[model samples]
Target: MKRTAALVALAAVPVLFLGVFFVLPVSGMVGLGLVSDGRFAPGEALEVLGRARVHRVLWFTVWAAALATAITLLLGIPAAYVLHRLDFPGRTVLRAAFMVPFVLPTVVVGIAFKHLFAGALAGLALDGTPVPIIAAMVFFNLAVVVRTVGTSWESLDPRPAEAAAALGAGGWRVFRTITLPALRTSIVSAATVVFLFCSTAFGIVLILGGLRYATIETEIYLLTTAHFDLPAAAALCLLQLFVVTLLLYAAHRARAAAPVPVERRAPGARRIRRTDLPAVLAAGVALVLIAFPVLDLVTGSLRHDGNWSLANYRALDQVGQGSLVEASVIEALVNSLRTAFDATWLALLIGGLVSVIVTRRSHSPTERRVRAGLDGFFMLPLGVSAVTLGFGFLITLDEPPVNFRDSPMLVPIAQALVALPLVVRTLAPVLAGIDDRQRQAAASLGASPLRTVLTIDLAVITRPLLAASGFAFAISLGEFGATSFLSRVDHPTLPVLIFRLLGTPGSHNYGMALAAAVVLAATTAAVMLLVERLRVPGVGGF
Candidate 1:
């Protein structure tokens, strides 16, 4: 009974936080579609599903996400093996470089691809096609595959493969029969996550696809903002929610199917051999794909009127021509930093509590089930559309009782919700890995529960806690979909400001957008680099 009471106490703040910030806002948005004249009417929203344009959006979202997921796996599996299983010079730097794209703002990635096609790869003529969209999705999600599979690969026992080779099985035969089976779970988990991110991608599709290609995410934004069609937006949101929920559940089931445990061995990263040429070549291609757009974005920012100059960067201190933005690029950057700082702490607090609640050794079957349910509940932000969350906030929280339309903390709170899942994912594994006997020992020594946690759990999770903070900070810095709806004109985040600048006409505006994107990308990359240095397991993995 005491243990159950303690579990309730531990879960109370996080549950309340998620209920108010996440559940309430999403439910309110769905209500807007179903409730009319105080009557529950879902038919009007469902009618949106029959629209021709909606069909096109859904089709494109599915095929594009599928294609991107396939390409990411193809490139990522070889690279993951080369980078994590083969010791090579500059591997750490290369690993960090590969991770930068995942943390980059979607708006920045969209703009970089545009510049890449227009300036450097103009002859390809793939500027406004679905090709770039798919490519960008691969570039953005490749890191997920690498991180997830590579983490598993690093810890995989080599004896099975070595034994297979000893019996005269060829390298290809051994890998196909031995290595692939071991990696099946992580591969599936990564693929599901990549598909989720691709299908729900907003800023990339919005900036690159424009009117030519529309994913469900961008379509929802257009329906809400441009068309003022809340019902249509709500319909798309429901569709997306259904699809994502199914995908996440499938991933969960795949991961839960326990693999036969092997006797553990230290990572045996061998020196590169002649046989590793193919993987090395693949990794080279992956690096080029990651580097091209970033290099193009940097060079594009330095050019003005066909001459290389710092004019675009200098213009950041001033608003664009014709008052395109209410705040200067520099001011917007300040807003982003301040918002991210606030968001980091909020995510860490709630996510830390959630990690503890879900990871604690449950004494009863009911307690275990409750903890499992809470674990999945906090991850809803990972699968739900960020734009829906932000839009919901505006419509639901503006009135009395929960008025936050004018609060400075509103944007930070929304970003925190977007980042909370990452925090929980990063910290929960570290917490769960702790031996319960340590806590029992502390308690037997007459330590209070709080003191037991402080001395035992905190000691183990401190590094992971710091890593989670940096990871959350980076995610909050790059969050755009929700920030678009909630950020005020006078206090826009950098991503919002860059999107606004892109919409405005003028070479100067375009140049400044590139420069600002570089700044945003650099900030997030620096944070991620620090997170990586901590060597926290599952820092960027699922």
Candidate 2:
């Protein structure tokens, strides 16, 4: 009875948190959009949905995401394969650190890409076009393909390929017949996630694509904020919700289709071989490609108009005070850190409780299915656009039972919502793998259920939980999508401040933006490195 009560209590926390903060706001936002004046009107929703601009935005979102996914796979697959087969110094370290780009704020990345390609694309003025936007998507999302597929590729049985080669099969033929089949499920899962991210993209689309490009996410933001067309934003949110649901469902099915476990051994970075030089060089090249934009951003911040100077860093003080954002550099940094601290605690508390409820003692098929359903539920926030959620906050939080419209907790609440899914993803896998036999053994030894959980399950997840905390902190520091909508002038996070600075004219404003982006990048990188260093040996990554 005590154990049952504990389980119920554990489930209630996440259930209540998500229901009140997430589901209620979104549902209320939709109702506000569907209703005309005081009455529910289907005609208003239909009219918004039937607009020609809506069709155009939907089409662009689909095709651009498809292009980005295809491009990412084409390059990411080769990189994953090379990293898997090669044994060299720093290989394991590289794999663990690959999340640097994935964890970066999209607004910061958008700024980096603009500088990286500004000269190259000057002839065509590609800022408002799809090319730069899709490229940015690839830059940010390639890590997904590499991590998921590489995790699978590293564990593939090599004997089958060796046997095939011995029987006169060529390398390509061996790969086609043996290696490719083993990686299909993971590859599909990675591709679907990449596609979903690119489709629901907000920061890059807005900053890079500008007004010329319109994805459903960007359109939703523009419709509500720029146009005050709540009904239109609501319609797009519905369509977005449906599309994201399908993608999440597809990703879940792909992950579920894997019949065998991947990464059976700890990642190994053995000595480099004579034959491994080519793959090693390729890996080095790949790393450089990924690392250059960041390096350039740092350099660009310090070098102003060809003369290296501290002028840009000095300008940081002038950028905020009594200026556009109204907060000093120190104030913004303090606010960001304070909010991130609160957000990380919230994510750890809520996600930890949910994971406790999700971790099962039995490995039955029904239990597995239920676990997967729970996984999908937790991850839905990630798949759903942050813009949609932000708009939901605008419409729902101004009145009634919990009128926190101007409350100080709003920023951290938004940050926590954004970080919760990642926390769950980070912690759930480790928790679910805990053998029920451990609990059973403890029970047989006369330990109570509560004691069994404390000593067994909780003890095991300690390191991974730390990793989750790092992720939550990093997310809170770098998040821009929802923060763009929710943050007020008085309290701006780094990414939000950076976006505003970049939007303003003048070289001073531009330099300050780069300087701020550098700070945000450094902050996120430090958090992720800590995570990599402290992570549990065999746990999955962000």
Candidate 3:
């Protein structure tokens, strides 16, 4: 009885928190759009479905996402193979450096890409085109494929492949027979994630595509803010939810069907083979392409009025940021840091509690399925996107019990909703992987359950917890879609301020935007690098 009570109490924390913050808000916003005059309208839905513009936007979104996913796979698969198969100088360093773009704020990426292709600094700018937008999606998504696929690729045993090769199998035949089948699961998982990200891309589409291009994401922003068509925005949100859910369901099925076998050998420690050279060289070129815009952003930040200058950064101390945004760059940074701190605490607290519940005593298949459902519940925020949360907050939080519409707390609450998934993903695996022997040993030594958890489980989970905290912080710092919509005018975040600065017309505004973007990117990279140093070998998605 006591044990059941404790489990229920532990589960209540995350359930209540997520229910109020994430579930209610999303339901409110999505529900309001699905109804007309408080009545369900099947005809309204059909009208939205039949609209020519809606179909156009939806189809374009599909085409763009498909093309972008294909490009990412073509680039990322060989890169993953190199990282998995070869030993080379600075290889780990190269891998870590390449990861910078993935964590970078989408707004900052848009800024860097715009300047590289459209600014006078590049001599041959490529702005206001689908090419730059697709390129930006590819830039941000390559790391996802490389990291996800590389993890599985590295652990694969080579004996089967070697035997097949020795038995008169050719290069392609050996790979087709052994390697391809083994890697299909990771490839599909990676590809699904990349496709989802590209499909829901916002800042890259907004900035690079100019005023003409519109995904369902950007259209929601346009309909809500620019055109004041709330109903249309809500309908678009529904359409987006439907598409994303179907894709997620498919990915889940694929992953469950193709389970990866455990490998007993150390990854990437095998003898180097001749075929690795091409993979290595391809990874090298990919790294250069990944690093170019970031390095160029740094250069642009320091170059003011055609010469090296600190004027752009120094002006961060003043109000308006040389734009009409009213907030200084320093203030924006402070707001972002503050939000990251609060959001990380909220996510870790709630996510850790939920993870404990999910990892708690479970023997039956029914119990395991319930735990899995709970896990997916926390992660629903990622699939739903921050834009939906922001919209939901506006629609739902004006009432008495949850009336935080005017408060600054909503900023990080939205961020926590987004960060909670990563926190759980980081901590749950470690928690579940805890050996039963350790706790049994502690109990044998007369340790209480509480003491055993503190001593054994806490010690093991601390580093991954810290890494999770760092990820939450980095994610909050770089968040743009929701922040742009939800943040208060006077208390804008760094990403929001950068977006505003980009809109103002002046050399100073442009330069300052570049400087702030570089600062944001650099800080995110620093956090990731620090966490990488602290991370253990087989933890969560770093």
Report the number of the highest-TM-score candidate: 1
TM-score each candidate.
Answer: 0.97, 0.92, 0.95
Candidate 2 overall Cα lDDT vs. reference?
0.79
Question: lDDT per model, in order?
Answer: 0.88, 0.79, 0.83
Ranking of models by lDDT: 1, 3, 2
Clashing pairs in 3: 117-125, 117-126
Q: Count the backbone clashes (under 3 Å) in each candidate.
A: 0, 0, 2
Sort the candidates on TM-score, descending order.
1, 3, 2
Query: TM-score of predicted model 1?
Result: 0.97
The clash number for model 3 is 2
Off by over 4 Å in 1: 258-261, 538-542
Give the alpha carbon lDDT tens digit for every residue of 386-429 in model 1: 88888889788888888999999999999999888888888888
lDDT of 2 by residue, 420-452 (tens): 877887888898888888888999999998899
Runs of candidate 2 with Cα error greater than 4 angstroms are 1-5, 120-125, 257-285, 320-323, 362-383, 446-450
For residue 503, give model 1's deviation from the true position in Å. Answer: 0.5
Model 3: per-residue lDDT, tens digit, 435-492? 8788989999999999999999999999999999988999989988877778888889
Task: Judging by lDDT, tell me the better candidate of 1 and 3.
Answer: 1
lDDT of model 1 at position 323:
53
